[model samples]
Target: MVLAWNGADPSEVGDGSNYELGVWYRAEVDITITHLRIWTGPGEINVTNRRGRIWSSGGGALAVITLPDNPGDGWTLHALTAPLQIDSGTTFLPSYSTGGNYGALPNALNANVPSADGNLVALSAANSPTGFNGTFNTDPETFPNSGFGAPFYGVDFQYTLGHGDATPPRIVDTSAIADGLQVTAAAVVEDDEDLTGLTLRIDWGDGTDATTVTYPTLQASHTYATSGIYPLLFRATDSSGETANRADFVQVFGADASSNRLNTKAMQQALASHAMVLGNFKTVSLHEPRVRPAEPLHVALWWSTITPIDASGLAVTSARVEWLLRMYTPGEQEPQDEMDAIIGDATDRLIGSLARDFDLDDHVVDGLVRMIDIRGAHGARLNAVAGWARWSDGMSRVVTVTIPVIVNDVWQEGAA
Candidate 1:
């Protein structure tokens, strides 16, 4: 299920001084649970890994405030979720307070919530006199991006329980596969949480690529403009953003009374297990673990194998993926020569030590994986660093490079 939080103001505020979210501001909240049967008083909600809470004011109202400065969560600042529990068939109208937790509470939204509606249920507001707005850059807003300038009672991602249907994708029906144009697609998309991106593999019968949608479930059909019984495949992403290959949707084109039946119906092998390495941007040291002068920067490597492979013996083959170096803005003098030296050293290390035997296409999930650190030799540069990722042997090639980054001073990425 998709949860969206948006920011706005009440009609009563004429000066628009409300919800500016200055240094601090408490918020009114209304929460609804769809397709579930559960109820309880949520003491607190999590936000940005921080925690916040709502409580009953002396005037039969709910009050929200940031956790103690110490927050007891072992963090100076936390990402918290606001949990304003509303009872069954009851509307909860929460008001903001002029105080944090110790002072008097004042509400911005008139505390007239209609909770008694049989179809209506839970609601509460967790606010601090302090504002909980987060900064933002330009992008047509979308889910995953928490609302700007406001907190949804401090919540990130939450899945409604039992909102998923345990079903893999299937190709229930389709029209005849054609020579120049053949269409194949999923028979249905169903889920408990809620269906998400659904993808279908389409083979145009020629050597052209197997058409695929990185994000599926949104489209209903795929057309191939070439001839051949391109083995078609199917994969569906679940509400929680998990993906699964639906081999049941495998089909073939060019199948007739002339060809061998099995060969005519080759499954979309391309829709095999997939893997993705998660990446994040964080503040880190420029030396030691990741980047080192005149040494290969050994970065933490992780991956989710999409296709199943017996990597018991496959060695990881790597190439000079990325070679980069960046420091603060400089003067008229350039550091090009220093950068060339740093990158040149990194290339030597990659050519010698990188794993050279493995089938990346058949990567097994949680199977044998490799990790290396960029370290220095006897006497190396103190601050220069270079890094790279393993590459496939011109086979199973996706992007041009494994560590698709190279050159020092080319990126501001201090951490990989």
Candidate 2:
């Protein structure tokens, strides 16, 4: 609700006549004034911008109105209807026959306004809605001493600025984690766009999921209650409204008590699958090839990997592993090579031996079946028939395919 007055000085009367105004001049183009008047007192003071903004009180600070650029002698004829700081109105007319230079003021509108306390209010100006900000140190108005026209009404205005790829997700380690211990298991989530918005989720491989998790720093310490394998999954999102999800597997094997009884050798090759089954390898009996052992019991193998972990990338060397296969007839006091021959078939001769269960902490029937299997799908023995595959499972895992040792008429194999 910016108002304008069109004269250098307020209309004043000293003795018999009112004060005459100065010549005409332009302020902003297209705006003009012919008659103007100024009286003292308070009245309704409205402030607004392009749209109506319902506003609060001025608190006595007046919405100082501006006068026209071309002030003339007819200014004194305009009369006031109200006071200085309040709402008041008085129409002005041209003194001469030529009439005043402009038409009447436009409609009163409303707009949005804010208080000095930072609270927003509704204001009206030209019957539309907009926003207005109130400042404490508003500029004081000064009645011009001498000028062709008055200044135009203006308000300070200020404007908020705010500120994310197709990067695909990747799988780092599809392995498993142990239980009852603080295992650092995690994956990294990334995006082609802004990487900040990407969130990481952890499925803990323990049958529970947590979306509040994030990646690149996946360090969850959840212990499994029982001994089993667990699989972990992860997903990511970007700021550009793009999402890339990735999932890797991990296992968390548990025991009756947290101890180091697990075979670390076998665990290295195991991949976690849905929190179940770790160190995915099997063992049994088969007739394939025995490099060092006698022809009585041969060995078959299937695996993959250019260089096995033990081979250390082409350092090619033999790996010896121990097998505890129950001789078809244990404690018969016969040599292992002879027993392997006496043993018969696919029907019932072979069994998942737990013969040592009769005793405590001691291995019963044992055989040293050396194998050539490396580490991979094809190289891995599991890729072949599930025979009594005997392969190394530790740092120095060795399967000694015993060559027939007939000493002093006593054909006895090495004690495992």
Candidate 3:
């Protein structure tokens, strides 16, 4: 729908030709134009020529052409030479200017209502009037002053759709994440003209309603309410009425023993997601040292970045991360009772360290621990132990286990 002016319709026609008059409109969506529907005079008007043109915000002309005159007046559809693409919020002037040979081209005056868009003026004072000599301020075309008063002239101009190169927006792949965690869904969309006019619609496929966004980036995040497979669909449309679609899948899981598997891909994904919570680190390496049956469970996490560890953006440090990994994999022990004491001490030390050195809270630390349990549920459980010697010295160890957590330069922190 176009040209719905709120004010009362005008009783008589206004002047056009000579000094050009056009209506300024802010496009709500990207649009491509082939012609403009301009309402003319109510009485029989003789018109040898009609020009439909557009000007940039700076009073520079972008496109202008002589339109074919249709018999009678009410709405005249003026065809354009080339398709003009108009982006949302881009201000441009669409009007009909007079030619060398002055003809009767009456500008239809709608009711003088305030412009719908703040920018609803008919003429720009910056452009000087032109005369027959093709020069400004010459005879017959004196400069128009005081003509630029407020309550912009009532003019009716609506755009007709033209050919637009509308391509589907490409939805970026989301990283594997655990349930209750936010995952950002991003996309890449472009057009022959400005991309700002493109709108993206995301259907999360979780039985919820779909969402639409304009000029969207890959930063929109959604947290799955439960663990399951979600089909992702994205549809992108441009102002010119062109559209495209793409589909993808997202797998979400919760922290459960049944969810943990000895799969290499799953292990890598889980570890990467966990390490990412440490904020922006330079390098990350997850290693599960071969564990003896009764020996202390050990997993090594090594990460570094070019930036200082204490930098404002880099919140996690090597010391803090070491303490976290220990909590997750503290290995099994011979006597379960004795093992509990060692685990208790380790937990206390973690809290003490935070209280004394790092000003962090128990609740925050507990949240991190929960993330580890859920993200690494499929991996071997690490039992907390004081030392290898604490294990029964005479017992023979039956099995060895290993888990690797690796992160490279591509690591990024998830939404807090």
lDDT per residue for candidate 2 within 1-416, as digits (tens), equals: 11243212222222221221111111221211211232311111121111101111322212223332333333222212222221112111111111112111121112323222221111233211112111111122211122211221111111001110124444434333444533445555443222433455556545565534543444555655564333444545432234544444433444442332222222221211210111111222222233323222222222222221332123233232222222222122246465444443321222211121211111111111122222322232311122243424211112322111000111122453
- Per-residue lDDT for 235-334 in model 1, tens only? 4554333454332222223333222111101211211111111111111122222222221222222221122222222342222122122221112123
Residue ranges of candidate 1 with Cα displaced over 4 Å: 2-158, 162-180, 196-226, 248-416
Which order, best to worst by lDDT? 3, 1, 2
- The TM-score, computed over Cα atoms with residue i paired to residue i, of candidate 1 is 0.28
* The candidate that achieves the highest lDDT relative to the unseen native structure: 3
Best-to-worst ranking by TM-score:
3, 1, 2
CA RMSD, predictions in order:
21.6, 28.4, 19.5
Q: What is the TM-score of each candidate against the true structure?
A: 0.28, 0.26, 0.29
**What is the lDDT for 132 in model 2?**
16
lDDT by residue (270-338, candidate 3, tens digit) is: 333333222222222354334323324222333221221221135332111222233222344457666
Better of 1 and 3 by lDDT: 3
Instruction: Compute the lDDT of residue 273 as modeled in candidate 2.
Output: 22
Clashes per candidate, residues 3 or more apart or on different chains: 64, 81, 13
Q: What residue runs in model 2 are displaced by over 4 Å at the alpha carbon? A: 1-165, 169-182, 214-219, 245-269, 272-416
Task: Tell me how candidate 3 scores on lDDT.
Answer: 0.41
